[model samples]
Target: MSRQVTPRAAPFRQFIVKVHGRCNLACRYCYLYEGPDHTWRTRPAAAGPKVLDQTATRIAEHAARHTLTDLSLVLHGGEPLLAGAARLAAFAERVRERVPRGCVVHTTVQTNATLLDDRRLAMLARHGVTVGVSLDGGRAAHNTLRVDHAGRPSWPAAVRGARLLAERYPDAYAGILTVVDPASDPVETYESLLTLRPPALDLLLPHGNWTAPPPGLPGRGTSYGDWLCTVFDRWWSAGRRETRIRLFEECLALLLGLPAATESLGTEPFTAVVVETDGSIEQVDSLKSAYEGAARTGLDIFRHSFDQALNHPGVAARQTGIAALSAQCQACPLVAVCGGGHYAHRYRAGHGFTNPSVYCTDLQRFIRHVASRLRESAALTSGGATR
Candidate 1:
C-alpha cells in the first residue's frame, strides 16, 4: 500500500513495525499480549522470511522516492527480542542496505528485557538498533503486574537482562518505556528510574478505554493525572540535567505555547501504522479498544505491499480527518494539545473513537499540573535558566 506516490504531503516521521509476535517474557500489561487481539496465536511468532524480504523492498522503494526527513522504523512485537539475534541482525542489514542514499533508516526496538543480554546487545549495536527496555520501575513497582504467563515475577530476570544489555552496549542502549501503575508510589518509582539515567524515558498511560478501564486506574477522578503529576514533579526536577521525559516534554511544550510534538499525549493525529505478525497492517494496536477486529486492514504486507496498503481507502480514511472524530473532544479546551488522545482510545462498544479519552479529564488535570509547574519553572528562572 503506497500513498499516492507523490512526495508525501509530509515526510514519514515514524513507522512501528511488528518484527515478531513471540516474546521471551509475557508481561501482563502488554497490549499486544494481554489485553486484546489474540490473533497472534495463528500467525508466525517471528517475522517470516518472505515477509521481511518484501518489507525491505517496499520500505526502500518508499524511502527512495519520498523526501523523508526522519523515517524511524521501530522494531516492536510480542517482543522483538524473540526474533533472535541472527535473524534480527540480518533483517537490520537488509534494511540498511536497501534504504535510499541520504535517507538514514533510524532503527529502534521496544522490548521486554527478559531476552536482552550481552550477545543481543552486541548484535543490536552492530545493526544500529537503539534499544529501549520496558520496565515499570524498581523491584516492587515492576513486579506489580509485569508477571509471566505462569504468574511469576519477571522483575529479577528483567533487571538482569537490562543490566547486561546496558552494560555491554551503553551507546546502543536507548531508553525506557515505563507504564505508570497508579497504585505505586510515584515519587519512589520516578527516583528509582532516575538512577538508571536513560537517554530518554517514555511514561506510558495504562492501556484500556471507557468500556473496561485500565487496571488499578479508575474511570473517574484524576487518578492517573495525580500519579503522573507526582512523577512529573520529581522527574522534572531530577531528570538528570538533560535527560528527556517524553510525556512531560509534551506537556511543557503545550504549556509554553508551543505546538505539541507527541501524538500519543496530545490531540495530534500522528502518522502511526502497525503491521501485525500475520502481515495485517492497521492503525496502532491500541485501537484494540475499538473491537476484537478493530485494527486489521484485511491485507497482508507480503501479498499487498505497504505501497498498496498505504493508499487503501480504509487506511487513508483514519489517517487524516482525525480532528473531526468526536464532538466532545472537539469542544474540549485541551483539544489542540491532546488531540483527543490516541485514536484507538476513542471507543466504547457502541460508542467509537469519538468520545473523550478515558483519561481525558486525567490528561487535562495532568496538563494543568505540568502547566502550573512550568509557570513556576519560568517564574523562578532568571534569564530563562532555572535557578
Candidate 2:
C-alpha cells in the first residue's frame, strides 16, 4: 500500500468570486452552462451587495485565522464583465477595506472580453483590478468555438477589447487565457496570441472527465500532447522567454526539481476556493465539469467560515497528495511532476476522483518530452563547463 498522505491545513490564498451567474455569450464548451451542472439556472443574474459584503467578511476572517499575509481575489463569472464596472469596483474596494492590516489583496477579473469598453477599463483601473481576457487563439478561425447565443462569432469584439486593454491599460492587463484546441496549428496559435502582446498566457486543457470526456480526444492517442510538444519546440528554440506560457513554464520548473507555480500540475496543496453568485462557498468551479453539484460544499459565506469549508471531504482529498490518487497513479514515475493531473480530470462515476486523469497518457508523454529536452540541455552545459 502507498503510504498515507495527510491533508495540509493551508488557508485559501485565491478566492474566485462569481459576480455574475449568466453570460451574454454562450460558448458551446462552457462547463458552467453547457456541462451537466444546472445549478446556475436558479442563481440570480448577478451577485447582490449582501453577497459581496459577506464574501469580503468571510475572506478577511479566514485570512486572520490563518495569518495569511497575501491573498488573490479573482472576479469570475458566467462572465464577470456582466456584473458591470461600478458594481465590480465597489466589490473589490470593499474586500480590500476588510482585509486585515499587513495582509495584501491582489484583485483581478477574468472576462470574456466582449463587454470591455473604455469606461469599464477606467473603472477597473481606478480600483486596481487587473483584467484578464479569454481568447482562444490569435485568428478568427481559432476562436470559432467561442461564439454567442445567436450562433454569431464573438472573435471581432473579443479581439477589439483585448487590443484596447493591451494598448490603454497595459499594466493592468493581466494576461490571456486560451484553451488548447488540438486541431489548431500550435505555432500559428502561439503567433496569433503574440499579436495581442499579453504579458503572459495560459494554455488550458479543455476541462473534461472520464465520463463526459473532452472533445477531439481520440480513444487512444495523444493528439493534445503532440500539439503542445510542437508549441514547446517552437518556444524552446526561440532562445528567449518571449511570452510566459504558464503550463510550459510550470512543467519545465517541475522537471528541474523546482516548485511549479500553477495548480494544474503540482503537488502543492490546493488553496483556492470559489464563492458562487448566491454566496455559496464551493471548491474550485472546475469540478462542475465532473457532474452536477460536484463543486458544492453546502457552505455559504453568509453563515460559515472558509475554515469550515476547508474540512469538506472533497476539498481535503485534493490536498492529500498521492494518497488521494489511484494505485496506478502512485506507482507512475511521472506522478510527482504531473501530480496525477488536475483533480477534476480524475473523476469517474463509480471510482470517483481516485482514478488517474483522463488525459494520463498525454500527460506522461508531454512530461517525458520536457524532461528529455531538459536532460539534453543539462548535458551540453556540463560538457561546455568541463571543456
Candidate 3:
C-alpha cells in the first residue's frame, strides 16, 4: 500500500478536468453555476486552445510521474458541451497523443443533454469517448429543478436530445445521470430512468458540505437516505443485469466484501483533481458551493503546464489534505463503506472540511443496512449459516 508506486490506485486514479466553464442551461442545483459560487462570471466562457494544450501536457506528466496506466479522466464543466467540437476534439487528441507510456486514457463527458446529437456523438465516438447525460429524473421530478432562466421546463428538450443520441449513436452514448432532489419519489424516478434503459445511471446527492447541508425540504433533512433505500430495494430486486446504477452498485459491493469503483462514494481517497476554465486547479468542483472560489488554484491553465499545476502547492494540498481527514473517518464503523461521504459533505466554514459527514446519521443508517447484509453474507459463505 505504499504511495510511491503500486497497482493500488494513487489516492485518486481519476481527474475531473474542467475544460470549459460556460453551460447551456441554468439548473437551480448546479454546483458550478448557481449552487455555491458565481466565479464562472469571470472565467473564460470556454477553454481556449492554449489552455487545452497545456492541460494535456500536465496530465501526461502526472501519469508518468505516478506510473499510472489506464486512468479515468472525466471531462467535466459547467457543461463540457459548451467547449464546442473543435476544442473538445483537440483536448481528446492531446490526451491520446501525449500521455506517457504507462498512462492509458479513457475519456467520458458529463453533459446537460441539450447539445447531445449525432454530430456531438460522432465527435465523441471518433475519439472513443463515452457520454453521460444529466437529467434530474422523470419530467416532473426533472423539470422542478432543471429549468431555463425563463422558468420553462428543460425535460422535454433534454429527453429529446438524449433520445436523438440514443437513436443515432447508441454505441457512443453511455448513460443517464440524475441528481436526486431528496424530495422526488425515488420509486418513480428509478422506474422512469429504468424505462429509458440507459446502459448506466448515476443518482447524485445535491452538492453540499457540513457548512451547508444539501438543499432539502423544509424539515426533511434525511430524505436523501430514504430516497436511496427505496432505489436500493428495487435496484437489487431488478438483478442489475442490463442497467447499472453506480451509487447503488458501490453500496452493494461494499456490502458483499467487494471494493467500490469510485473513491468519492466509497473507501477510496479523494483521488480526483479538477481544472477550471481559467486554468486554476483545485479539488472537487462541488466545493465551489461551500465558498465563492472554493475550486481556485493560482496557476492559469493558459500560462502554466499541467505538471506545474498538478504539483503546485494548491493542487497537491487537496490530495495531501485528505490524510488529515481520514483519521476521523478511518475509525468510524461506516467509514470503510461511506468513506466519509463526499468531500463537499464534510465542509464547514470555520472548521473547514474537518467535520463529520453532513449525511452523518443518514450514511450511518445505510451502513448498518449494508453491514447487516455483509454479516449475513459472510456467515453463509463460512458455513451456510445466518448470524
| Regions of candidate 3 where Cα sits further than 4 Å from its true position | 1-12, 217-221, 261-263, 302-323, 326-330, 374-387
Ranking by TM-score: 2, 1, 3
Tell me the tens digit of each residue's lDDT in model 2 across 148-240: 899999999998899999999998999999988888889999988989989889888889988888975536899888888888888889863
Identify the superior model by TM-score, candidate 2 or candidate 3: 2
TM-scores for the candidates:
0.90, 0.96, 0.86
- Quantify how close model 2 is to the true structure by its C-alpha RMSD in Å: 3.4
lDDT of 1 by residue, 1-387 (tens): 343533333334566778888776666556766666777788787778877777777677667666554577888887787778777778777977888777788888888787777777888888788888888885655566777778877887788877776567778878888888888888888777766667788988877887777764445578888999887877777643646888888877766678676756654435666766666766677766556777777776666655555565545544554455588777777666677776566567776566777777788898878778877766877656743
The per-model lDDT (C-alpha) reads 0.72, 0.87, 0.70
Residue 131's lDDT within candidate 3 is: 83
Score candidate 2 by lDDT. 0.87
What tens-digit string does per-residue lDDT give for candidate 3 at 1-387?
112333233434676777777776777667776666887787787776776677777777677766776777788887788777556766887887887775678888888787777787788888878888888775655567687778788777788878877777778778998777666778888888766668898777777776666665223356777777777777766666758888877887776668775634565434667777666666667777788877666665555544454454434534443354646776776665777777677778887776667777777766676566557656778885543
Candidate closest to the true structure, highest lDDT: 2
- TM-score, cand. 3 vs. native: 0.86
**Candidate 3: residue 219 lDDT (0-100):** 39
